[model samples]
Target chain A: MKSNEVRVARFDGYERVMHWMAALSFLYAALTGLAIWSPVLYWMAALSGGGFVIRGTHPWSGVLFTAVIGWMFARWAKTMGLDADDRVWLTRMDKYATHQHDALPESGKFNAGQKMLFWSQVVTALLLMVSGVVLWFPEWMPRSLRLVAIAMHPLAAIGSIAGIIVHIYMGTMSVPRSMRAMLLGWVTPNWARLHHPKWYREWRGSTNLR
Target chain B: MLVAKLIDTTLCIGCKACEVACQEWNDQEYTLGTFNGSYQTMPDLAPNFWNLIKFNEVQRNGAEAWLMSKYQCMHCADAGCLAACPAPGAITQLANGTVDFVHENCIGCGYCITGCPFDVPKLSPASKKVYKCSLCSDRTAVGLEPACIKTCPTNCLTFGERDEMIRVAEIRTRELKADGFKDAGIYNPAGVGGTNVIYVLNDAKQPEQYGLPKDPIIPWTVQLWKGPLKALGAMVFMGSILGAFFHYVVFGPQQEEAADEVE
Candidate 1:
């Protein structure tokens, strides 16, 4: 029989819903964005109804995605703040990559990797929104301004997508227990102890375990 | 045989008939609204707007000049968008050398956003799809000129075989030089593995003068990183699935290894 261990809620119902909403919107925006960027991926139109439909949807959805990310940032900004331990953890990422569990640093609510992801998403979300608006209303601005936005938009998108690819991999596959936190809103005490010892201790002190 | 477009910027009158014709013939929507002094409402290509007429005012030798160019996909032979796309059916090159889009197979990953040098592709927010100029493949299949070329009142845009387009561009360049335009030249013949779209500049301005890259090539780091990273991600996903299956099948969903270690 499984032990009856109490696990504190890291994400409330609203937070969890927002988290998945942002994720789904981001995924959709990323795909449509790629389709418009290359003829090689033009077939993506079939997924969204047709090419014309894809054209109509890409930019508006981008707005929604950006809006949701903004809300998420505001809600989680305080918790995602980095500390000295996080810096040290980031510096030793290779150990984590190689699956050296013992060599990994102890963390609080979020590990160094999670903090890095949080910050990266924040930066990317801002860049995409700003650059997107510039492109949307190019005639209102000077030609030079539009050119700069065009150049920056692609560069920012590339960097963000690369960051997101790693993020999804880590969230879903590399760390088995991480997904459960986002999904069911609970984790085993052993998992909390191993991954986030500080949070585990704090939670244990505040609430009794069965 | 790659089909291409030869655009004579010198002859372009900035009437924007080509822009209108393209939208009407392709059945694309008029997404651009009046903003600047000109009727060319389109600022850039979008999912709905594939072709755009860019108007630039330049001062050359103390003389005022209006530089007009039609912007669209270059349809590069080694298209960065092609290499970067995760979906197999999103983009394809036709047998006649035209880059084609198939919306059915796209997952909208936005990889092509960084892959394109010209920044041609655009996403639609309403339907979550990509859109760009398809060179009027449907029209071209029946040997009809593209809507933009057919509608150019100044006879500025011409479509033909790639080799023939280059020849026309060269002849036009010579004519411009003879007419005392020393900087007249043909653009993008050999760059980016040669582009399907050719341009004829009236003045001595290089391609960069018209907002094009002098030497457009895919970034080496993007190429190097994407292939291995994708492979590693796939491997990890597959490995996890397999590991889960093996554990459930062999150990009947409850492994004794943890218990043995505790003992």
Candidate 2:
């Protein structure tokens, strides 16, 4: 809370906007899709504006999510790649999960776990999109293709949903100030130094800060 | 007492009366006649047109012979449409053994179309709802035979108890066999748990010639997808969410160190 405290820029405005767009569309698609997947969750259709509205809107929301994720992939794929340090950090993920952050290697802007979450989402988003298209236009597809899609869509959805659950938990609960970084596009220098020391050092080096 | 309809293909004169009667009784929109180089009304059933009399020209004793059968929803006891439908109550197997589609709940996803082994259900382009034969559930509920069975001039279509219909079909099949139809048999396909709408085909061995699958079954892939795979997906979903909740409880958020604060 000091007035002289330094603020490190984490995410830009454009990145934060794209991230939220993806999050919202993903939530919409997931809820509606679950409504259609099981009788137990059939009541969810009412939450998503009923079965009729969801049938018309769910696929389109999936398209929007895929498009946004694709954009994020293009913008972040290079920096999100796994390096030697990230591989070592992956081995010590238990320490990272248990709040023993100092036991793990210094992380970059994104840690190994975060990068894994990003890549898994992108892969599953593409899977959902392809299978979703097959389901959206059943008449155009053959029986064999339809069979594969009917199974693939939900399986891929499970993958992405699992990743997002962890992503939300980590951003909001496990790590402090991480939500603020995506929300306001900056984090306190102490937060950066504790969580992503390598990135913090790079920012200091670039800015000539002691 | 499960009700059923038995169609005797041998007795059918290809009069097309039952087809017209079904259209009239159901109050379905009239489909325009299209010639496809044969007396067969339409190549296949339409969303609006629920019933059709398929005309097949096959070689019998080196001579061309016509094979006809009334084609509509088989109303399978284990209907794939009911099994594949994600929208609860959209497709249901009625107490009287009729599989009906509730138009109101239909999301028009066409999963039923994919699920159906007989390819009976059709999605309407205009309303985006699926349509098929309800076996005159409205009429049968009132203790009356289906419109198709009532209107059949040749008495080819008969409606009664499931066991009685099967017994009648067996007798007719035996008679056809005696008349030199060696392949004549009942077409109630046990693979689908026997259809409420059974058939007595003259050439049961060659049912594909009558536009019916030789051995109709709900694809195993569809069964797995709607069954165990769905359960697996639900488990994974619950596991992830619960895991996150418990992890948060056990290990609190990684708090920022006080010493890291700059003076």
Candidate 3:
């Protein structure tokens, strides 16, 4: 919007709030999880008022995270669904890393990589919630099952965290103005046209049909 | 002064007096409850109650059998609870092979609970600290036996040097074997460097029936995830940062929307 006279909406108020809530919950869960998983990261326990609080608070944070992510999935699952173009876009990662947008596929509301992150989060979030619940009150389940869940929770956390790192980089640097779109709920027509031309065409109904 | 205990289950009369003495000695107030089909008062261990007498009533070839096993911390030589403890001075291993918990130092993380192969440590909601059978180090340091051992009426529970206790347990095992109990053996499982407390069980084949693991070892999941996977996670994290840095060095800043490109 600052770059152009016309302001096009990207994220709604509900989407922005949900995103921040998810982000905060994710960060707290990750920190607490790391603090519990190994002693080397035990200093993180101090950040959350010592190891006991971190240990006790982590499962609840995971509950909040799962709830928020569930809501986000309900809202964004359709728009983020992958298609043939998205699959093709996956093959051109070198071009993407090098910033060759001209060689990339025309994207919809979300690009191929964003769609991958969306699906990855969908799976990881569910796995983490299930494993976290089993680990929280392990006595509720059999010891054999609890041991399996204990092994699973950290690996799920690792996966979601790695995806999130790439997502943050993509939003901030790889695709500049994406964070602004999420923050302000709008992007300039120029940004839309250059980054997501097919979406811009759909929104503006412009004469440049190509 | 490293102490150990020998529990002869064959001589145990299934009396809950040791359980009562443990509660009184530790000053842990647990609600008295109705019998839940078995003589055992409580179903499992609690933060307040550091000891338990698990009663298992199983039938063998149409004959009634009663199994009563006293349950408490095993206090291993290679303690996973101590290995997983993040706080310094929270858990200490004595020269006498007594693994002790310092409540003041416990940050109430419950990591010790999961770290334990025996499910011994319990976290209290009130104090937010982990508690377990201390092996009565408070009494042992003053040259007194543990309350449980002292209160055992049949003299089934005895305390002495850890090495001597093992020999006593072996002797009991031989006696049980001669008495027509073919499966008799000492339960000082070597999977965790053997336990400080030894058990001479009549039927050692099914330790699980007495709420004990047949082959207890520190969980492999804890070992790999906390040990090697951690380093790999750090590498992946640092790799991302370095990837970003090198991208900047190679490709420079990404191009934004061009001034001339318009709808």
List DockQ for all candidates. Answer: 0.08, 0.62, 0.42
- Model 3 lDDT, residue B176, Cα: 82
Please list all clashing residue pairs in model 3, or write none if there are none. B2-B96
Q: Which ten residues in a row have the lowest lDDT in candidate 2 chain A?
A: A1-10
What docking grade does candidate 1 earn? Answer: incorrect
Task: Write model 2 residue lDDT over B1-263, tens digit each, in one string.
Answer: 89999999889999999888999999988988799898988988889888899998888779987889889999998888888899887887888899988999898999998888888888888998889998988998899999999999987999999999999999999999999999999899988899999999988988887888988888877888788878888889889889889988998778854545442
Q: What's the count of clashing pairs in each model shown?
A: 43, 0, 1
Give per-residue CA lDDT, model 1, range A17-119, as digits (tens): 8889888888888787665544555567579875556645767877888888888888888888988878888888767665565675678898877877878
Q: With candidate 3 superimposed using the best TM-score fit, by how many Å does residue B208's alpha carbon deviate from the native?
A: 4.3
**Native interface contacts kept by each candidate, as a fraction:** 0.00, 0.66, 0.34
- Kindly list the per-residue Cα lDDT of model 3 for residues A1-210, writing each as its tens digit: 234766778889999999989999999999888777666777877898876676678888989989998999999998988788888899997888888878889888788888888889989999999877777764455566666776678788888888887777777776777889988899888888777777887887743323
lDDT agreement with native, every candidate = 0.72, 0.88, 0.82
TM-score of each: 0.58, 0.96, 0.90
Number of the predicted model whose TM-score against the real structure is largest: 2
The ten-residue window of minimal lDDT in model 1 chain B covers B254-263
Worst 10 residues of 1 chain A by lDDT: A138-147
* Model 3 / residue B205 / CA error / Å: 3.4
Q: After superposition, how far is residue A124 of candidate 3 from its true place, in Å?
A: 1.1
For model 2, residues A28-136, the per-residue Cα lDDT tens digits are 9999998998888889999877897899999999999999999999999999999999999999988887888778888899999999999999999999999899999
Give candidate 2's error at residue A56 in angstroms.
Answer: 0.8
